[model samples]
Target: MTDYFWDFDGTLYDTYRGMVKSFVIACTESGFKVESDQVYKSMRRTSLHQTFAIFLKNVDFKKKQRIVTRYETVEKSEQTNDRPFKGAAEVCKWVIEQNGRNFLVTHRNKSALNMLKRDQFTSLFTGCVTSENNFPRKPNPASLNFLCDQYQVDKDNSFMVGDRALDIEAAHKAGIKGILFDPDDIIFVETVPDKRIKSLLKIIV
Candidate 1:
């Protein structure tokens, strides 16, 4: 069985609304005004810090973190439109049935895992590693190494699936095949799985 590493936001749960809400709250409360479209566009692939600065410019990192932390709580308990993507449950179940371990990796603060716990996603993953209460976030290999050491996941047989270039880069760096999430977003993965698909269902199932 191939061990799987997955991303949380956008990969499984549809937290775009919550993300938008949290970002708006964080930026505005910190100091600046953020237009909805700008925020929306930033959501496509922006890093959390960059996203924060786009709205909460000039804010100290520590204070900015507070804004983001508070917003995370709101997104957790105040879930309005949260949902697992189409066939997410099925894909997860299939992985389990195939005797594969599924790890949820996200740049989201670990506090957001509380939302997953409240939302019942904790039951779905073998392990959920978030950027908050853990090692450096994705695009970085520290977290990935932590996961490998913790789970004894086979790097050769293992794989990563994410919508970001960093995900593939990390997978390659960690010696795992990088299976990109967007079939339409072709990239230069010339030596690995180098495969891209639109849906996790297509790859995992």
Candidate 2:
């Protein structure tokens, strides 16, 4: 059975809107007005940290840190409002019904688990690796390798499903397939993934 390694934000869940909103609010509060579309594009192409670095390049480290802290606080406070994408739960359940397993690898801290629990998705995963684990962030493959070793995952049959290029790169680095879930068709990656689909339900084994 194939194992599915899932990304949390923008993959299984439609969290980018909330993330962008929070980021915009934080930046505006810090006296930096950013366009939401630009922020979304940057975030989708790179990461939150990179996005901050890109926008706050001229800001002092102290101000940047404050903005980041504020963003995190806003995001955490609105975590309950975030929801999984349509058919996300169905696709995950479909994998289990096919005797496959689901795993979560996210940059988010323990709050990711809290969201899963809140959404009643905690039991859907066989394993998870989050920021709490302190593993190097994705595209590094450290977290993926840890899960592969820990659960004895079959690299050939398994796939890492994520919305960003880093996820595909990380899966490849870990010796597994990558599935790019690009609903908006805005993401551009130099390397092609094993499969690219717009819907979570298209991830059939």
Candidate 3:
């Protein structure tokens, strides 16, 4: 059976709204004005860290840390705003029904699991690797490698599904197929994934 590795933000959950809003608020509170649309676009094009660099350019490291901390604080407090995209739960269930295993690999800390539990999705996963795992973030495959080794996963039949090129890169580095889930067709990445789908329901186990 095929195994799946999932990304939380933007992949399983439609979280960019809350994340972008919190980031904007944090930046504004820190005396930096930023456009939400631009921030969203940058985040889609790259990553949260890179997007912060784009907006927080010329800022000192300490101030950048403060804004990031503020963003995280606001985001965590407003976690109720994050929700799984349509078919996210269904797709995970489908994988299980097909005798496939589903695992989560996310940069989010334990909060990722908390949100999953809140959404009643915790039982759907065989395992998860979160920020607390301390594996290098994607496009590094350290976490994926760890999961594969720990679970005795068949890399040839496993896939990593995420919304960013870094996810695909990590999957490749881990010797697994990558599926790019770009529901809005807004992401542009040079790395070619094993497959690309605009919807979660399109995933074939």
| lDDT (0 to 1) per candidate | 0.72, 0.93, 0.92
Q: Candidate 1 residues 87-171, lDDT tens each?
A: 6678777878888878877887665577667667677777767766566766777777778889899898887777666777778
RMSD of 2: 0.9
lDDT of 3 at 17: 94
Model 3 scores a TM of 0.96
lDDT of 3 by residue, 122-203 (tens): 9999999998989898999999999999999999999999999999999999999999999878877778998999989999
RMSD of each: 3.5, 0.9, 1.2
Q: Name the candidate that leads on TM-score.
A: 2
Tell me the TM-score of each prediction against the true structure: 0.78, 0.98, 0.96
lDDT of 3 at 204: 53
How close to the true structure is residue 44 of candidate 2, measured as C-alpha lDDT?
94
Q: How many backbone clashes does candidate 1 have?
A: 0
Q: Write the per-residue lDDT of candidate 2 for residues 65-147, one digit (tens) a residue.
A: 99999999999877879999998899999999989999999998888898899899989999999999999999999999999
lDDT of model 1 at position 199? 80
